[model samples]
Target: MLNTQWRVLFVFIVLLIASALIANHLTGRVFNYHDPIGSVRAIYEDIKTKIEMAEESELTAIKTIAAPSLSAKTAMQKHLPQADTTRCVDVSLGKVKYKRNGNIYTWTDSNGVPHFSDEKPDFEAATLDTDFVEPLDYFELTLHAANLPPSFTEELRIKLNTVFKVYGQIIGVDALKKVRLNLTVFATRRSYEQAIKLRGADPTNTDGMYFHSTNSALINYRNEQSAMRTAVHEAVHAVNKAILGSTPRWLNEGLAEYFEYTKNSMQLVSVEPHPGWVNNKRVAQSVFTINWLIGLDDTWQTGDDTKLYASSWAAIYFMMDSNKGKQFLKSIMLAEQKSPCSKLTAAELKNMLYQHFPQLDKDYRQWLKTPFRKQSF
Candidate 1:
């Protein structure tokens, strides 16, 4: 009915109109185009849900990480006993709490002595004793002397204090003053055994022990002499821990063995020489040499604990007897203390001996063959 060009234009317009109608229909059906605002609201709701889920997941992760430390603190709190403020001598029963009473207060004097007061003392250097003992300059002595006589307990306390003072001198006054010791003496063997059981240690194996976790030492007092010697032996380990942080296994046991035979008198306290009764017999039978001692491993596990102890003690004794060795030992101790993470390696010990005492190897061999002699501290 029209010209060719006009007819083609009309057909094209009709096709475009039909395509638009189809597109609108498809969009409305598939995309909910009629409720455009609702579609946007659905999308926002999905995003909100995902964000909330992510936050919840993050919160769960945080809780998982924090749970163990919280449980550990709670467990420690449960295991340790509460503090008692009524007594003059406070025992370490868990964390030391310095709660003030009505007007009667407890405090430590400048000399690190604990005292009670109705009014605040005139001393400017007074600190709360119970809290300060474990945390500061003074060592804490918790004596459970329920079965022993009161006089004996009092005397024992004095002797132990003297031991601490002697240890301070050996390590250096300033070094020892930085840390505190926690010593627990069980009055009877029964109580000591009970404590060993509670602590998950073998009573048969351990007569005295130093617990690193709690920074405490435990001893069974059989009599005056035995208790004192044992305390000194354990205290050496404690001193090492406080100052050097880590000591070689041989040196640690060796020092303990060497120091165990201390002679305590009214005038002085000294580390006496070994009588050779405990370890000398074993040491005498074994092939003893400087290189052998240095290279010796499988120390305690090889069922040669007695020999190991003797060898260690003998080595320490030889070194300690010499003035040069004393200075060398002091230098190493100071170095180790300054760097807490450092350990006493075998190489370092050998190198030090070589530097300080070049003929140490020869001297040590000669000393090993000699009989044990009593030397004054």
Candidate 2:
């Protein structure tokens, strides 16, 4: 929506420039007796004023329709008082439920895999290090929490940073330099549910969600690893809302699941598919054809079927693995952001697939037969 408004403003600016040029050309011929400079100045000012009003009206409509709460409206208004491109406000971390004590603990488990915890470890070898706190301005993502363990918070911050880095590289870092996505994580499901209720959204059976109006992702801290995955998933939504306006549900959710796993390496610098940590093999085998997957009516609104999730990941995975695929995905993302008021028809989607992947049908079959490999990056 924001991107649409800016595009509108850009058109207005171009029109203004053309108008000025025409006015200058006509002034001498139409009114030779009068001062041409003064007439052009008046015309320019009038056009500028009208453009500003149009921009304001568009913003007002967005505020009334899109912002779900009074707080959200107020925040949008405060941050976006005008249509200044460089002054746009990307998303920021909104709420933190727990206070920071500035402490971090390091310990090793029985398997010798090292772990960090906010609480002091029972192991005599555990060490407390208060010196290595994550600075607030050090990264592109901010993690807000409620009663979360400091160690877990630190882990989330680190992992989410890696997620952002990997995602930025995949999508092109220059495209995302303007986004600052935020994630609000709660220590318990009870707190997470309560927060969503207060915000006027149904939690339903969802473990995580990203609110565009509020510009933040929310998650409940369940099992540490699972919670991190949830956080990464929702973070994808937040980033998409900021950078791409609105995305198709398949691409949105697939990209989230793609980044939800921890492969013991934070540096995922390549496009090779991670041996997806999610249990999606059965679904992939069932929905073997890309045509069958895209044939499902209303692909954008398809609900949380395991088959849908697996197929979505497969589609994105296939796209991201090659340079041509990455470029196509990038073009789609830019197009989606540029068009907030338009909807892509089914025929249009099919044509787009063929344009980008001429051999999609044959290639997809080959992809299904190939064994999934754990990513080296």
Candidate 3:
């Protein structure tokens, strides 16, 4: 009985030992009871949540870093003005911006047009070096006499106004309506002569040329009638420039002579045809002599220096008298805008003259042969 009881006890101890080993194996393979599988699963879920949160945080950081750069670019685009794309590259001092349709400058409007802005750059003001008086529409004459005769200046102004009226009639009064004529008289002939000589011109030339510098015309006081004629002559030249771009040098000097001699006198005059006429006689004498004679052609040479004044006066008179003469003058004026006189040939000019004044061919030829009484002023 004792041996059987001991055997049972040994069996029980072996069974207990085997049970312990099996439980250890099972725990290691399936559940891992020492490490706790549920705890490991909870740790994995926490790690995954942390990883997702980290990713979101990194994305937010990237956006925050990029926001300012994008905002800055947008702000710059909004602040900048557009530019004028139609115009060639603008070198003007202003901020420029390019657009789809046109370019806009910072200082200018949508069409790249300028505005009266205090901050805007002054284009005209910057270039103006001298004290410039803006032109007036109508000028009131105030003749202050020093050494010059008061009558001479007064008569000069009257003759000037008359020639101005003549040209105004031809090219419309509105053309010269805005021109301001200021005539200042000088006491000494030396001053007037010095002024002319400075311009590389002869002072004795009765028809004084226009001075573009001051817009002021000067005439010497020799006699009232002569001074009046000189004033009218110069004033016509100025009027011609106002109406027509510029009267040809020949036409200009000739017209000046015409005004000097005629001045509203209705008399038949003949012109002498001589090469030395311009050199020997005064401008008035040369022109008057030629007006009395005939066989003169409208085709005049450039810088002929002889008979220039005479031929010019006759041509101008011929044109002024004919129906188509005025139209031809207009054509000549228009042509001058495109080309110089040297470019036009003698034949072309002759054809133009004939086309304008067909009656000139016969009447002028007959007038040249006929003798007329000369009227003295």
Candidate of highest lDDT: 2
Question: Over 4 Å off in model 1, which ranges?
Answer: 1-138, 149-171, 187-191, 276-298, 369-371
TM-scores of the candidates in the order shown: 0.54, 0.55, 0.44
Ranked by TM-score from best down, the candidates are 2, 1, 3
How many pairs in model 2 have backbone atoms within 3 A of each other, for residues 3 or more apart or on separate chains, i.e. clashes? 3
Residues 194-256 of candidate 2 have per-residue lDDT tens digits of: 988887776655667667665677776666766766776776666665666555666766677
On the 0 to 100 scale, the lDDT of residue 81 in model 1 is 13
Point out where model 2 deviates above 4 Å: 1-140, 167-171, 262-285, 291-304, 340-345
Which candidate's TM-score is highest? Answer: 2
Better of 2 and 3 by TM-score: 2
Model 3 lDDT tens row, 126-218 = 222233222222233444346556666655555555554445445444344433444444456677678667755555433244564444466
